[model samples]
Target: MTDKIYNVLFLCTGNSARSIIAEALLNRAGKGRFRAYSAGSQPKGEVHPYTLDLLRSLNYDISDARSKSWVEFSADGAPQMDFVFTVCDSAAAESCPIWPGHPITAHWGVPDPAAAEGSESEKRLAFADAHRMLGNRVNAFVSLPLASLDRLTTEGRVREIGRSLSEAG
Candidate 1:
């Protein structure tokens, strides 16, 4: 396997939940193989409380997690991403900045747990479900033999992972 580490970016309308969960999942699952970052087109400016709670419960380090703008990734000297995935339908529909390396992009839209309305337990369940769905997708992504695949094949595989999971349930 190649020693190179890949950079990945996850986007959403709000930087509060789904994208943040995705970032955490990929960072943990991909570990030495991939570095993950997240941002929003219209950031909420703060992460959702439940998001932090869920991650904390899962033993994830959230000390450095905060909602940020996608503009940060587009800035000069920003890390060039190998892949970019939009986890929200709204974000997928919006105009995105030109990524430095022309990274392969995909839509891995997940239902907004933050939008779930009901009892506290129900709301938390939404967050859990979102996390589970993203975990499956992230696992599929990290399993790919990226070093042996051509860029086109890698792109196709990533897109398929998103597409297949989005259709699940």
Candidate 2:
């Protein structure tokens, strides 16, 4: 097998919650095989507090997590991503900058935990649910036989993973 490290970018309307959680989950679960980044069409300029709390409780490293614009990824010197996933519906619908490598893309929309309206515990539960869903999808992605599969097959698999997860809601 080739020792290729795939770069992935997760996008959302705000880079504060779903995308941020996805980035952390993939970076940890990917075991150095994948490098994950998160960004927004319109970033909130800060990672959401609840997201940070949830990640911390799960023992994930949050030092690198930050709310930034997707433009950062499109600019010169940015890493050329092999895959890109939109974690929110708004971001999936919005037009995005043309990526340099023409990376395979998918939409893995998850509910916005930060948008949950309820008591503190209830809101935290929403974050937990988002975490569970994204974790399931990311784990499925990393388990794919990416090196052996043809490009078309791999792309279809990734898209199917997204669709399956979205439908589980």
Candidate 3:
């Protein structure tokens, strides 16, 4: 296998919750095999508090997490992404900037936990649920035989991972 480390970007409307969670999960899960980044079309300008808490509770390092714009990754000198995923419905439906490398893109839409109503406990549960869903998808993705698969097959498998949750129920 080639010692190529893949770069993955997770996109969402706000970059505060879902995408942030995905980034953390993939980075840790992929180990040194992938570098994960998260950004938004319209960044909230800060990481969501509950997101930080969720990640911290799970023992993920939150030091590098921040809400950033997709424009940052599109610029020259930014790491070229091998894969790009949209984790929110709004971001998936919007027009995205043309990525330099033409990375394989997929939609892994999950409900906005930050949009969850009710008490703090309920909102926290929403974040946890989002975390769980994203975790399942990311786990499936990392389990793929990436090095052995052709580009077309790899793309299909990644997209399939996003669909597994809905298809499961």
Candidate 4:
């Protein structure tokens, strides 16, 4: 792979939470390393309000955030993804789109923040945790020598990276 910035897609069932966090983190983390996008296997039709709040609190420019379908990326003219990660446990287990460019796929499931119970603070905590965990993983991923890793090495590394992202932070 050349040193050009690679496109990454993070998917979930809703596209309203985890996948959105992952996308925002990667995109804000740098300018020309990894271009991130997100979608849902079954979109919830709107980006979650809490998701927007968390990003804004961190000063992330999320004015453009919205829930979208993974099918867009499946199109021939869409940005060719170098990596496609399903950020929801449900989406990770469900069927995925047959991608163009054969992007390296991984699963980095984070428990749904919207599913968090209790008070508002507790729900915020869940979002914060997911945001941090995904942020850490995306940070580490972009730091990897993706352009240098060989084919077999990259495939194995993608899984390793996913585990590291899911378990860390």
lDDT scores in order: 0.95, 0.96, 0.94, 0.86
- Estimated TM-score per prediction? 0.98, 0.98, 0.97, 0.94
**Residue 133 deviation, candidate 1, in Å?**
0.5
Model 4 lDDT, full chain set? 0.86
lDDT of 1 by residue, 1-169 (tens): 5898999999999999999999999999997899999999999999999999999999987887899999999999999999999999999999999999899999898999999999999999999999999999999999999999999999899989988988682
Per-residue lDDT tens digits for candidate 3, residues 67-94, read 9999999999999999999999999999
Give Cα distance to truth, residue 128, candidate 4, Å: 0.3
Q: Residue 38's C-alpha lDDT in candidate 2? A: 97
Preferred candidate (lDDT higher): 2 or 4 = 2
Segments of candidate 4 deviating more than 4 angstroms: 1-3
Q: Model 4: per-residue lDDT, tens digit, 41-61?
A: 989989999999999999998
Q: What TM-score does candidate 2 get on C-alpha atoms?
A: 0.98
Best-to-worst TM-score order: 2, 1, 3, 4
Question: Which has the higher TM-score value, candidate number 3 or candidate number 4?
Answer: 3
> Can you list the residue pairs that collide in candidate 4?
none
**Cα shift from native, residue 150, model 1 (Å):** 0.7
What value does the lDDT take at residue 140 in candidate 3?
88
